[model samples]
Target: MNLEPMAGFLTFWAWWVAALVLAAVETVAPGAFMLWLGIAAGLTGFVTLATGLGWEGQLAVFAILAIVSVLWGRKWAKRHQGSGPSSVSRRADQLPGRAVVLVEPILHGTGRAELDDTVWLVTGPDAPAGTVMRIVRTEGATLIVEHIG
Candidate 1:
C-alpha cells in the first residue's frame, strides 16, 4: 500500500534495471517483441537520468517510446520480409520451386506429393505418380505444383 520506502530504489536506475530484466526475459521467450520494450525502457531510463523527469513523465516517455519502437520495428520487419529463411514459420512455404515426384496422381487439380520425407496435399493439373513436378505455391495446406517437363 505504502510505496514511500521504495522511493529511493525507484530512481532512474530502476528503469535501467527493469530494462535489463526485460531484455533477459526476451532472450528466453518467443517472439522479438520484448526486445523492443526493453529498448524503450532503456531509453526512458536514459532520459529520466539526464533530465530528471518525474515518475509520471518517465512513464509517459516509456509509453511513447514503446509505441514508436514497435511501429518502427514492424515497418522494418516488412521491409526485410522474405529476406531471411524462406520458412520462418509455415513449413509448407519452404516447398515452393522445389522439385518433387507425385506420390499420388493429381485429379481435378488436387493430389499428394512427398517432400523432405513428408507427404503433403498438393494442388495442380492432373499428373500421374512418378511424374516430376515443381512446387509453385501453396493454398492453405495444399502445395500448388506444375508438371516439370
Candidate 2:
C-alpha cells in the first residue's frame, strides 16, 4: 500500500475530528479531564493549519498542548472550585442554617419539615407541627435541626 496518501490524511480536519470525539466522550462521562484534552486537540488543529507541520511535529505539538492544557485546567478548576452550583444534588449540604417549618410533629426526635417544594426528614427535640426549626447539620439524608423561638 502507498503511504503517501495516508501521510496526507493527518491534517487539521483530522485533529478537529479527534477533538470533537474527545468532547463527545467528555459529555458522556464528564469529570473535566476529557474537556481539556478536547481543547488541546482543537488548538492543535489550528496550529497544524497555520504551521503545516509534519506528522511528527504535529504529534509533538499535540503532546505538549495536551499536558499544558490539562495542567492549566486543573489549576483553573482549583481556583474556581465551589463557585458553581454549591450543592446541586446534595440538598442536605445547602440546608445548614436554613429555617424550615415542621409539617409533621417531631414525636420521637424525627419529623418532616417543608422547605420550598421538598420535604426533609429532620432529627431534633420533640416538637409539634408548625414549629420553626433551623438546620444544624446533616447525617446522610437526615437533617439535624434545632428549635428556634
Candidate 3:
C-alpha cells in the first residue's frame, strides 16, 4: 500500500550496518582507515535523516564524508603521533653512552668488552684488554665502541 517511507528506513538501516561493520574492522586493524569510513557512513545516515536526499545525493555525501575524515585523520596523526623510541630500544641506547672496559681487545674493528660484569658486544677502534671504551652507539643488542686507546 505505502512503501516509500519504509524504503527510506531500510536505507537508513543499511547505512547504520555499514558504519558499524567498518568500525569493528577498524578496531581489529587499528589503522584508522576503516574507522574513518565508519564515521562517513554514520554521518551520511544522519544527513539522510535530516535532508532525505535521493540515492545519488546520498552516495555523494558518503564520498565527501570519507574523504574529509581521512584527510583530517592524516593531519591529526602527523601532529599527535611520532616515531618516538620505544622503552626497550631507549634502554639499549642508554647503554652506549656508558663506560665499559675492554675485557677482550678490539682487533680489526671487532671485539668484546665488559660493562658491569655483562659483556658488551662492541665495534670500532681497536683497544687492548684493560683499556676503557665508551659506547658510541648501539647495534641490535650489541654496543658499538670507541677506544680510549
Candidate 3 lDDT tens digits, 27-126: 7896789988999999998888777777999999999999999999888877787557566657886775677888888889888888877887788787
Off by over 4 Å in 2: 1-35, 45-52, 80-86
TM-score of each: 0.56, 0.63, 0.71
Per-residue alpha-carbon lDDT of model 2 for 8-34, expressed as tens digits? Answer: 446888999999999999988868899
Residue lDDT tens for model 1, 1-149 = 98754453467778888889989999999877888898999999888877777789998999999999888877888788745665657776667889988889999988888988888899889989988899999888788899786
Candidate 3 TM-score over all chains jointly: 0.71
lDDT for residue 74 in candidate 3, whole number 0-100: 82
On TM-score, the stronger of 1 and 2 is 2
Q: Against the true structure, whose TM-score is highest?
A: 3
Worst 10 residues of 1 by lDDT: 3-12
* Each model's lDDT: 0.84, 0.88, 0.84
TM-score of 1: 0.56
